[model samples]
Target: MLLISTQNITVKLKYYFNNNGQHYFQRSIPRALQRFYGDKKIVRHKLPSIHSQMLLEMNRLAHHYDQHFKALKSGQGGTPSQIQEQAVALLASHGVLPGAANTPARVPEGMYEYPHLDYIEDYLRDKKQAGTMTKVDELAQLLLSKPMPILLSQATDVYFENHEHGTSEKFKKNTLKRWKNIYDVTGGDIALADVTREMARRYIKHRLTTVKTTTVERELKTIRAVINSVIKEKSLNLSNKFERLTIPKKGKDSVARKPFSQDEYRKLIAGCVSKADEIRVLILICCLTGVRPSEAAGLRREDVYLDDEYPHFDVVEYGGRTLKTKNSVRKVPLIPAAAKVLAQYLETHTDSVVFPRYCDGNEVLGDNVSGATNRYIASLGISKTLYSARHTVKTLLDQAGTPEYLAESIGGWGKPSISRGYGDGHSLARKYAALQKALTTVLVNESE
Candidate 1:
């Protein structure tokens, strides 16, 4: 018999021979002592010989149960019932109790459990005695409510499904694609808390080798948006890990997009006259109205109001088209060239879409239209893209001395001043006049 003394309690281990000369081990506590475990004779069979390994294993098991019982006695463990059940489980696992082989271990309830929660509880109890538990409880609740080790992938899915509502299908698709690419780079299964600024910088560095800095910045922006949305919706106290990552700005070494000069614009217009009428009109609309190619291509017949006094088209968000910004939702005044193109288009057009060749069910119309436009421009010995038309419009507006506010209004660009909020904005008549003056000046210069 060996007596092991724990916290004010003694456990007796005895070795004996069974009827068939098989050795066995048994553990017991005094029946009169009801403190640690209620009076019971804990016994087990198939004992190892009294060797160093066997004695070491027995000592480890005794120390493990002793710590558990100490926690229970000191009110550090959970409820009495929980402690009792766990103690029985611990003893059974080490074969210190009879029928230990048949006992099943307890399964935790929630999907995630943390050992730090025990330490947190102990700290709370100490703080409560010191009358400083108020602020501590707040911090404790934040930890307690937070899901342990939330994955960036999981949070991103939840954010899009529940939080990101009313977004256009095109925008959603692009955003999701960017997110998937980011997940692949950043490790989808990585804990959100584990994503450091250094990791983000490394990701940007890796991407910069193959993609533009702007593209990497956009991906990081999406990551930041997803993390922010999840934190806000779930009321998580965690900070956004991607917020502080530094993104490089476009430098002198960057290949800047070349905007069309006056002569280049005229050459493009002249060259495209023999092309498809839809393509010609699409290019004209982009130049004259400054609406994005996607916005113009996704335009429906109802969006065009050529008969109105202003003769403008609505750049509204519908179908699968998405505006770049809320300010992109404005009435774009059709210049004479654009109006002439629209009239010609409406004469033979039967489809609802203004540009049927480019649109294909939730696909980004701009990408398809721009690809074709770029190819056509390349054939003309010029390197201008379809978006060069927008830069041309801006240049024309500047030359025509169009006021900043009116020019922004005409281009459906975001307002640059807080004062813009105080008024109803430039009237359609004012916008049309500004655009006419600019387009007429450019056209006359081209003709000269």
Candidate 2:
């Protein structure tokens, strides 16, 4: 078969042939045609495409002709078949299949590439929606997968929207400051996976023995929160490290908790001078009502109900800075003596506050009444922090045959444990009133 084309003085032609059982090609046909016409432009334009197709056809024909030649030579008993067999035998001896050798080697496509972070972020987001886990748990899980900076950023975002966020601005500031401090100490650059158990153990050691245990524990809890959140939100794999991290048990003498004894209370009240009368009255009100200093400070004249079946003060105003917990909000019943003290204190002032001077009926007393109260307690040769009043209430409830659960409830202790017997509900005044009543009962019995 032959193909030819010409334009002006150029000519292009393809010649194909079969000879016996073989295919042959002659290259001189295109040169012969170009000489016959001399049109080089047409020859140049079609040369590349024509040459490529002819080469492919020639290669295919050579392959077919070689197969036929091999068969014929094999029957003729030549060395060609023997050489071919020997070649195949060598390949097979080397554990290579001759049939497969020509089938073309297949190269498996490279594996799918993936980003390491996408797995971690997805796990954290999934964990966040599951409500059962604590925020600390979620955070710990997140931190375990993500880097510290990412975890820290997430924690900061969550902290601003938490129950603690709405508390006193000081509380928020202090918490943020603590986080920054931890970040500085930890280098703030490592991934959660890189933070090994050994590092955690060392950090815990530093917190318990050198630094304040509470401070370290608080920061630890925050970090734990980050991990837990990640696991909760993203389904990230993580171990619960907080389970192994033990916070120190507070020593009895360390926390500055002292409940006033009967004699100490009497001496404290007696030591109030003319100028310190308001503080004295405040102490008395605290002792009798068993209200916290902050709760007491926020008390208003109108908040007291003298006409109810039981005269009591409604602790509606939390510390001007905080509402604290739900237990802090309740009506605290006052005994007749405490009620009388409150009435007398209110008579001296015509403002909203039951004890107006502390706030000028505007601001509430914060958690720092210790300075004034401590001075007054010291003047009487008695030494005690005003918080001792709260403990005093717990001790009094125990001594007066009040049921533990009732006492705990009155003190706002949801569940009274064997260790920390009473709750934080005004433990001072309740205990003081109970002690005074017991003393009076003892004196009456002795007189009889």
> Relative to the true structure, how large is the alpha-carbon lDDT of every model?
0.65, 0.52
Task: Please give the TM-score that candidate 2 achieves against the real structure.
Answer: 0.49
- The per-residue C-alpha lDDT of model 1 at residue 379 equals 85
lDDT of 2 by residue, 21-47 (tens): 243453321222222122221211111
**TM-scores, one per candidate:** 0.60, 0.49
* Best candidate (score: TM-score): 1
lDDT of 1: 0.65
Give the candidate number with the greatest lDDT: 1
Name the lDDT value of residue 73 in candidate 1: 49
**Tens-place lDDT digits, model 1, residues 30-98:** 333234332445534354565555666666656655665444445543433334434443334234342
Task: Candidate 1: list runs displaced more than 4 Å.
Answer: 1-153, 165-168, 183-194, 232-238, 248-256, 360-364, 416-426, 441-448
